[model samples]
Target: MAASLCYMNPTMIVTTSHRSSAELWRQAEEWAQRIGARAVRRQGSLAHLCELHEADGVLTITNDRLVYREPASGLEYFFHPGMAKVRIHNIEVGRGDPMIGAMQLRPGDGLLDCTVGRASDAVVAAYVAGPQGHILGLEKVPVIAQLTIHGLATYEDSSRKVTQLLRRIEVVQADYNDYLPACADDSFDTVYFDPVFHEPVEKSEPMKPLRELADKATVTAGALQQALRVARRSVVIKQRYGTPLWDQLGITQVLSSRSSRIEYGIAEP
Candidate 1:
């Protein structure tokens, strides 16, 4: 399946939580400015705010976390490690992760995540990369990018190791299309792309909200070429099993797990 290019809804309003403090309001205003949205006072519920502002969604900045709410669907998106914690625990127990296997990551290696949605894979990659390695995640969507940046900086885990690894990831608000070309050859050990799956996974309820907010742009051949040029070892693409993207991109080296419907298509630079 091929993905069609789509962007975040422009009609989004940023507001503070109900009973918000002064600092939270200030932060909301700053976020609104950063994302090119209007900052409004929180009067009632998120749904009411959406109706009043005629916005497609409302981004509420609370003391604990940032929440993006779509009134129509009642979908709330926030930053969480999601399955990264489980993947990390699996790694700790000597279980293999398909993504880590595909990337062939090593300590001190540099990784560029071209489509770092919520930084879940990036967090897992960071854990495998260790202290000396670098993980840079590029996200084009404004609200999602900002939310990820904030989450990576603030979200904590029961394990100190996990918390530290999350902090190691660097989230950048830029599209890979513009960010990759300017890079020098062999800029990173690996470049990874996890575009929104063209076919939705029925069991992936957590991804539904993210899919709605993410950039639906599929990885173009030109972009893949740029990634190849930038990566020293290889470029990896993640897609649902049986996706035509593997053949369309001419990637023959594919990795998969018997338990997962996801597959990684790898191409060496």
Candidate 2:
């Protein structure tokens, strides 16, 4: 269970949106009851806002979806239309792009996303692979996994394709370093990793909160070797251009873009 895997904020309050329909508040209270979180009226001086410094965060249920507001971080996290990575994938798809050509995924390919942060890549993979394919995402941090799941479930988009893609992914809370090694040989058509970059860069507001909750586990040589063994075709690693993680893993074949700072390293099995 997620509770056993990682302890979430015990003081996290489930509250309604400041301005929302009455149904939204009812849903929020029911959700709060289900999650064992305190649900209070949206009036002033609620315990959640009162204990601002003492509380870890506030999980606010708006008419659309769940939003996590962290006062200490001064950041709000929720799923919306303007995710940068997903926009990049959409643009590339329009161009018939092959940023990670070696993946060679078809409609029936099975993919394992080692680090499914924001699940942008997983969404793209599922879109290309279609309903017949399998897409499994492993997230070490249970809180982030739960947040992503909620976003996927609650957010309604005008694009039916996007909504379907989001629904296709299966997310699990597990350390990939342990899970990857246990998988049988040739278990998946592609195994991919996009670990947080080792270098420090200016982050956007959304990334700031994510960085706080991300798994700090480094991708080791042994784990890379295991990924290669488990993958039937190729293993891809996404990282910032010229990241030392590539050198550490000795990844030679790379696909890059002069237009952007991100790059993908490919390892064929």
Candidate 3:
């Protein structure tokens, strides 16, 4: 169970669970009691806002949901679009996380990290290939951009493994809608997307922080079309193991590590 509980305000508590799906709910309730904070479980995320006491806090059961939370980090990490939600296990940044562990990064290559929340994947990729390669992390939210820059700059000072390995990362605070055009045609080798994890519109929701952002940005097939447009090599979509992505898009399932199934959509040659 990967969960954290902290006081967001004098009265409210934010509990985050980033582990096994089955254990996430049980751990969330436990964290709430351990810290005496209000617990909001992020299950069946489809609505714009989950039930909350304040005007803030939206629903977020997927990477897409967090993107709307961008621009707001540090201390509370409020501006992050969420972490590098990928699957490539055994890599230090997101070790054992199949969503983060199953990445296919070759050495001495460049990758456009669509959402560089905490830069977990950027650091891991940089380490994998060495300094000849570069990673451009695009973020629309100012808070997340600033945090990523600061964190990447200071990463060397904190963890020797990451510090020596992450010198090639570049963090940019720009909406992808605007920046994707700047890249030359077929410029990048990979375009990775962890779109918001939303439930069917009618299901009951569990997370409150994600409610507001969901109202602002709707993660439909059209949004994903944008991701497909900007990539040259492959588009990687992260989702549940058994979930069928055909309803969302026509992505060919290409990789799977543990339970984090990765589907790839390659542009026509």
Considering every candidate listed, which one attains the maximal TM-score?
Answer: 1
Per-residue accuracy of model 2 over 14-99 as CA lDDT, tens digit each = 77767867898787777666545666656653344737535666677766567767666666666543463465465556754454
**Model 1 root-mean-square deviation:** 2.0
TM-score of each: 0.95, 0.78, 0.54
Q: Looking at model 1, which ten-residue stretch has the lowest summed lDDT?
A: 1-10
Candidate 1: segments with Cα more than 4 A from true spot: 1-5
Error of 2 at 21 (Å): 11
From the highest lDDT down, the ranking of the candidates is 1, 2, 3
Superposed Cα RMSD, model 3 = 13.5
Stretches of candidate 2 above 4 Å error? 1-13, 17-53, 81-94, 98-102, 200-206
Local distance difference test, candidate 2: 0.72
Clash number for model 3?
Answer: 30
Write one digit per residue (lDDT tens) for candidate 1, span 1-269. 13334563558999987888989999999999877899999998788888999999888888877888888987889988889989988998998788999999999999999999899999999999999999999998988898899889998888888889889999999889989998999999999999999898778998899898888888889899999999999999999988998878899999976467889999998
Indicate the residue-level lDDT of 29 in model 2: 75
For model 3 the local lDDT of residue 216 reads 24
- Give the lowest summed-lDDT range of ten residues in model 2: 1-10
Better of 1 and 2 by TM-score: 1
TM-score of 3: 0.54
Model 3 has an lDDT value of 0.47
